[model samples]
Target: MSGRSDKKGEMMMVQADTRIVDVIRQMQEQRKQDRQIFYDIYSQQEKRQDPEKKDTGLFFFRGEKKAPFAVVCAGGGFYYVGSVHESFPHALELSRQGYNAFALQYRTGGAEVACEDLAAAISFIFSHAQELGVSTDCYSLWGGSAGARMAAYLGSYGPARFGGDDLPGPGAVIMQYTGHTDYTENDPPTYACVGENDGIANWRTMEERIENLDAAGIRTEFHHYPDLQHGFGLGIGTSAEGWINDAIAFWQAQIDES
Candidate 1:
């Protein structure tokens, strides 16, 4: 709430149902500005030779007037900045479809220890929902690969470095080739799998972790395109459209149920 640029309010419109096309335009502009700000900040820090200054950027998309918002987390190996060209498009497309979309940025690799950056971002979303124009009550996390792992950890109410008990878990999720834990009796959580190919498919070690959450009646939808690989959710290389479509449907289904 403190640092949110007054500029955001200028672009936001209280449109009916918050259309996707208009939202994407605003989100893209915001993303560009945020990235540039971070880039320059890092540039200055680099000149100063401050090891504490991180180059990883922070950018979040915005929706129209929707109470519940959809947040997108881009996957980076806890090692590097996630793909903006690849991951952010999902936010744009979702905004076009009438969902407030945010493509979040977090510390990458071991920048701030291990996963502290991601946890901080999650906590920020929860604690600052009012400023972000999102409902603290409902959140749907969409991520692929490392993003998926982070999302799953946040969604499952699992132990996070920042802790999210103050923030409600995602109402629904779209997991594609995620990796957090083995799909076992205790993990791999069944309710979240729209299991694509590889990675999250660690069923051999734990027989589909998603089943457990599904059994608990959590709102979850699974989609699989065996032709896909790790970063399918970004809608990048092969079968990207399939991943987007499936994720949208999953989100829609959950929204309907609510």
Candidate 2:
């Protein structure tokens, strides 16, 4: 098993053409086998009766006791199909780095419950810090695109605050190509590159929220791949290795600092 001090971190390769629905099903099986931790935390409308369903299948990865444990969220637009290969790979990589890493297949959508799921996931991880061999007090949220949006939302408004004297939330948050927010000069070049796809024109209602999070002192880091589109950081297509390396570097810095 790769670990923090080890040169080779945990690695995952998101397979091509895998759909989100299947991912959800696979996770369900894992849950049944009792090999998984944390809850799926979705709703009825998101499941049966709706005919067509979209669920963020959750995955958990544990590691040695350490600060800045990770709650990784993968970017699936308000609807990122579960790219387990893209998502869990990163979590496993981080775990091997010796931090408790969780790849949350959070409920996707603008539902109020979905938002709750995000908060609940972090709270759940922290809720059981000891079993995972870490302190719940310190953790970081890492996500891309849709996952990034949710992470930023939770990071900004979810809880990770410092107001109530020892606020309950992750100490760090990172965005690979977070959509669903306005642009800023400090945004990564990728953001500028995806003008039409992830452009400022893309989000109008949530700009204020993004700004508010900044104002609240949330440690937000935005990375834009000027040439890569929305899911650039997902380690898909031709850039999987580079994406993983970039993610490893990004995550390692956060973990060590955490």
Estimated TM-score for each candidate: 0.65, 0.59
Model 2 quality (TM-score): 0.59
lDDT against the true structure, per candidate, is 0.52, 0.51
Candidate 2, 1-258: lDDT as tens digits:
336313211221223333344446545765788765554533566466542334543566656765457767765555643446446656766666667777776555553444455676666555556665666654667776666665555654544331112245445556554445543333321111121234532432334434655665543333333222345444444333355455455545554565
Cα lDDT tens digits for candidate 1, 42-139? 34544377454454434555456645666566666666645453356667677667676666665565423323444555566566667666665546
Model 1 gets an lDDT of 0.52
Question: Model 2 residue 109 lDDT?
Answer: 58
User: Which one is best on lDDT?
Assistant: 1
Which residue runs does candidate 2 get wrong by more than 4 Å?
A: 1-57, 160-167, 182-222, 234-258
